[model samples]
Target: GTLVEEVKGRRFAVSGSGFWQVHPASATTLVDAVLAGADVRPGDRVLDLYAGAGLFSAFLAEACAPGELVSVEGNRRASADAGENLADRPNAAVVHAPVERALRRGALGARADVVVLDPPRTGAKEAVAAIAALEPRRIVYVACDPAALARDLATFGRLGYGLESLRGFALFPMTHHVECVAVLARA
Candidate 1:
């Protein structure tokens, strides 16, 4: 697969074997998630936790025109790829670190408006706490496992973030796997 694609008038640069192993949510799913829960707009500052090759970061940058779009990843390869993918976007900042450390280091200050978390099957508990402390206007969570999503949702509730909306995408046509996106707002 190619590293670049023009989807709906926006250019997305993806790295990592240039393969389709990680199928980012389809165009429809992306649009639906944003429409359902994102409270982003021009000039908002955003954070993409567990950013892979910067897929969501690129989309957020295009949609929100955020003052800053920070992409954080711990894997060296993924971090390098994310940096490459977002290199052209002046508003995008790629941080090579674990999500918990990045958030704890005050990478997300008190002024961020939007935060996106697309963690692995094992969700991010510490990172979630950091995000809650920031009190962003909105938080978008993407998860591949329902159990993890539920657990994280419970954590969010304890931290005063209400579940605003949720949408699921069948990225895998016939498997038991499902991808979910949830929007959360400060309660």
Candidate 2:
């Protein structure tokens, strides 16, 4: 990873670590999926889980005013970098902790209006439950693995979240890996 990279015209430090490594096209696809049917209000609070370096948080910042978004990541370095990336965003705070622990620990309360999560290839099982606990109106999940996405979707279902839209992207090209973005709404 490069020390600094640009996404959607926003530049940030990657720290030579590929935490949020993904093709630019894939990134665009994921962001597009999240923004497609998103109903973000100006004063709505947003929870960004697995918010490596505040990628999607930038979007939230644009939609909501300052102090309306909380971005959580497990990696310390990535979280630190997120601090800098989201520095200009006074309202978007980065919490350096795992998504599950952060939510389970009550890092983010039930005040979130929307939640955007871009978990790793393993997907987020417990984290999904935690997000469900928040009872946000909408949830946008960016999944790198189909199997994990399926399992987590079931968990969301059990938690009373309904899958509204799902889109797949062949981001890796010839590789078997496909990125899927799913938007879920509370039922």
Candidate 3:
């Protein structure tokens, strides 16, 4: 099924498959948080990890006009959908590969200005190691689980990155689930 999500008055039609929730408020929070945390600049390269429907890809590509934006996703359908959703952005590219494998193969490029990863509830331990290797200037991580976020922050510490800021949102609206976005920069 196709669902419409409007973030900051910008509309995006996203596929509802792919084992993730296409919640509008969550999308807005993530997009806003990433932009605030990354402080993207023109001509900066950006990497979107676990880019389900290319939401952040569109956001980053438009913000950093003419800059390079590459989004990596493991699911085939979601990748295709992202490709279509991000079609208008000439600076964006969607790779249909898992983040770990893509990083191992050097597909997402090296040392981007910003890297945004919206990992699943289990967290992105394996992917963070690879993301840290990218040495991106800023890392905007969107996590659904606090424990996972904490653990990844620890890994980033070991890699010489320090958490710049963290913001929590009541994305689940009264549930125990909270969505958090953490920003990390080189210390």
Candidate 4:
């Protein structure tokens, strides 16, 4: 089954039990945060790693018209949904592979102007070096775990990426869970 969610006037098709943000307001909040931090320019190449059902990729694709937006996801169902969700955008493509493997195999291309990633609670420790290797101008990281985010941020720092700005959101309400969107830039 497919579930279509409308966020900030954009429709996203999520298939099966794919990873859609748990919070009702999460999609819009994260999209706004990422777009502001990305500062994407026209014709700029963008990469959306760990993309789930093309949530952020759809918006980025519009912002970087005539450029390219490569969305990579490990989950089979989610990737399929992403492809369908972004079908209207000719400049957008969805790759079904783990973020680490895709980056290692150069599946995303040689360079990216901006990179937006929403890794799981464990974060993207394994893909930090490879992502930094792309030398993107800006990296917008959406993290669900503070500990994992800190560890990954430290790794990014050593790779010449400095934390430019970070915003935290209490999307979980009563729970202690907090979502943090951190933007990093090559130094």
Give candidate 2's whole-model lDDT.
0.82
Residue pairs whose backbone atoms clash in candidate 1: none
Candidate 4, residue 86: the lDDT equals 94
In candidate 1, stretches whose alpha carbon ends up further than 4 angstroms from where it belongs are 1-6, 9-28
Model 2: residues >4 Å from true position, as ranges?
none
The sequence of per-residue lDDT tens digits that candidate 3 reaches over residues 1-187 is 8776667776666677654453546777677788889888999999989998887888899988889999889989889878887888999999999888999888776678889998888899888888988888999999899999999999999999999999998877668988889999999
**TM-score of each prediction:** 0.86, 0.93, 0.93, 0.97
By TM-score, rank the candidates, best first. Answer: 4, 3, 2, 1
Task: Compare candidates 2 and 4 on TM-score and give the better one.
Answer: 4
Better lDDT candidate (1, 3) = 3
Best by lDDT: 4
lDDT of each: 0.78, 0.82, 0.85, 0.92
User: Higher lDDT: candidate 1 or 2?
Assistant: 2
> Judged by TM-score relative to the true structure, which candidate is superior, 1 or 4?
4
Model 4, stretches more than 4 Å misplaced? none
Residues 73-152, candidate 1: write the lDDT tens digits.
88877778778777778888888889898778886566678888888888986777788888889999988899989988
lDDT of 3 at 109: 67
How big is the positional error of residue 161 in model 1, measured in Å on the Cα after superposition?
A: 0.9
Query: Which prediction has the highest TM-score against the true structure?
Result: 4
